[model samples]
Target: MTDTTNTDEQDPAQAEEGAIMRFMRATELDTRLLGMVAALLLIWVGFHFFGYFKNGFAAFLTPRNLWNLSVQTSSIGIMATGMVLVIVTRHIDLSVGSVLGFSAIVMGVLQVNILPEYLGLGHPLIWIIAVIAGILVGALVGSLHGFLIAYGGIPAFIVTLGGLLVWRGMAFLIARGETISPVDSTFALLGGGPYGAIGAVGSWIVGLGACAIIIFLAWRGRANRRLHGFKLRPMWAEYFMTGLACAVAIGATLLVNSYPWPKGIVRRYAAANDITVPEGGLFISHGFAIPVLILLAVGVLMTILMTRTRFGRYVFAIGGNPEAAKLAGINTEWMTVKIFALMGGLAGLSAVVASARLGSATNALGTLDELYVIAAAVIGGTSLSGGIGTIYGAILGALVMQSLQTGMVLIGFDAAMQQVVVGTVLVLAVYLDNKYRGATK
Candidate 1:
């Protein structure tokens, strides 16, 4: 009671802060991420209602379509992560589509023709060997391009543009312009299908594990902040974040579990297992595809690489100011080569998923993929001017781009119209990015 009535002036900044701004600050949420999420939700809802009104069925929001959309997004999403680094460093790789096709062709030839001859058909080692070989081929191609740009003084644009044509031509030559089919059964599973999915129980396990990890990470982060004498988020904020992440994990698990295997597949599965079908039809969840898992793994690894490594710091430093970075003792030239090599390796991995998904390899497998990859990165908020990007952003961008195409397809838009719409969106994304940057400045 001695000085209870005494008052202190409120801080000017706090006094001016609005409720939305205060909430954002407390949660430490990324505005860009929130914007993208809102946009995606809008797209999903719009497409779902449109489909319902037009066709008397809500096709877009169905489990079947969403599951298929995730699979389709896998290839482009895989490549889009690497594209973030490339664009963040103020460079471009026009050859990723070509590289994917070329590497996929190499993997196909090895599994279908060469390895089978040496290791015999259905050899356990064939898939592993082919995968490794494809990744190496991609890395080698990327390194060569990086070398030309960093050492030979050729511009990245020129180098990758030349590579685009060269690699496609090389893919055609490798297969003699023919498709390779009936890949190793084990390898085909990597592409994803009923056989390639993890099922309901596995999905639940993964979801719970993810939730656990999220909570642990959040706790550790707070501990580290305290240890380093940095400010800590309020307990409520910490709980909010952890809960949000866990909810997302659980929700995704529910979504994937809700989509049952097709009736034909169920019948075949039951016959193979010697089980009688129930009257209502057997229910088998296609919980999550192997390819989707692969994409998630890549995203986690890339996020770690970018956020918790010296190599990552170097990449951002170079992107922020190449000349200054070099002057500060960073080996910018070699770093460029390494970055490109990583991009190439990812492209190779994407090739594996793409060709495996198709159950065959064709010289035309990755046609125009470059356009999608770049657009995804850009739409996710990677700055072409350099030094700003996030791995998750690119993944979300890839999903958005794929969602647009899928929604259009569901509504019966032809290939030409799809391309036009995608193109317009890309331009709009760029314009928004520029405006956002300007306003922030």
Candidate 2:
């Protein structure tokens, strides 16, 4: 009656202004991050096309390679998210690697040695309790670091440096210079090898679920922005980007799902174990590793905590100007403690994933990983000086780092070169951040 169709068509462009503006703002803020993403994709393509063999697909781009690459990145990816929060608050956690080793040892000891003798628990329940114990041990270590830095007023670097030694020593005491292995099949799945994989079907389900959630959130965010009178991108742009994202998501799922397991290998494997073979020639695919899912979950939580909550606001405020935040009545010290605690928690999760993946626990479980985690965070565009970072970017940074490592392996390059390249990348990232900040000032 009131030309409603015409009105709708006419106002649709304006209606999406809020979403468009927000997207643009984020893009502008994350220009470097976008560039890093592009760089990662380029590496993926380049390594396959240019490096080593003239194989059908680039070596690194193969389904098995990609699947393994993702799993390799998972542990550090989890830590990188938490490192984002710590770096955002202008703090650092130098002991995460050691804590990971110590906590992992705690988990392993509980599952293999302690439980059999004392609790006599079996299967899923023991696995569950062991993981919780690992996490708790990690939190305790984090709380101690937090207290020392926040309450005792010791410098964060110094306090965490001390923790680096103490935790590693504890791990040594736990393991006594021996590798502990033969973990339960269920417990081993957490580490993400074939035994730990969710398989192809499970991977598809997870990927689809993740994609759906992302799209729903994007739509809801746009609607909220429009309601709040914020500017947004045009509807066309939103749809285009969203479509692109969905395409990538589905493509990734297919790639992982299509990696063919050798028929002979499956047959022999079944035969050796006297297991029944299905009619469809094994009907199996290694979909996604559970650790990847865990990393995704941690990444999402970190992203939300850093972007959507009061704690996030305070973190930025304190990082930007501690004195000003304190003047504004924020509990800066306690917040610092909490941030470190979160970092410790993620490190604990990393231990769980790493220990599970290896099917063993050793004192050297997390050796040098603190450096890896820090470098990933910095390369992802988390500022060392603080007040800036993103969990997604940090996770991507971990991916990029692992990509380089995996590519080198595929190409048969010296593994030691990884440290050289990572060091260079890290130095370059710090230099760029400093330059950008200076230019801005």
Whose TM-score is greatest here?
1
Whole-model lDDT values for every prediction: 0.93, 0.83
Weakest 10 consecutive residues, lDDT, candidate 2?
A: 20-29
True-vs-predicted CA distance for residue 197, candidate 2, Å: 2.1
TM-score versus the correct structure, for each prediction: 0.97, 0.88
lDDT of 1 by residue, 127-170 (tens): 99989998899999999999999999999999999999999999
**Poorest stretch of ten by lDDT in candidate 1:** 1-10
- Which sections of candidate 2 miss by over 4 Å? 1-29, 53-58, 262-265, 268-283, 433-441
Task: Give the per-residue lDDT digits (tens) of candidate 2, residues 251-291.
Answer: 87887777656677678778989988888887567677788
Q: What is the lDDT of candidate 1?
A: 0.93
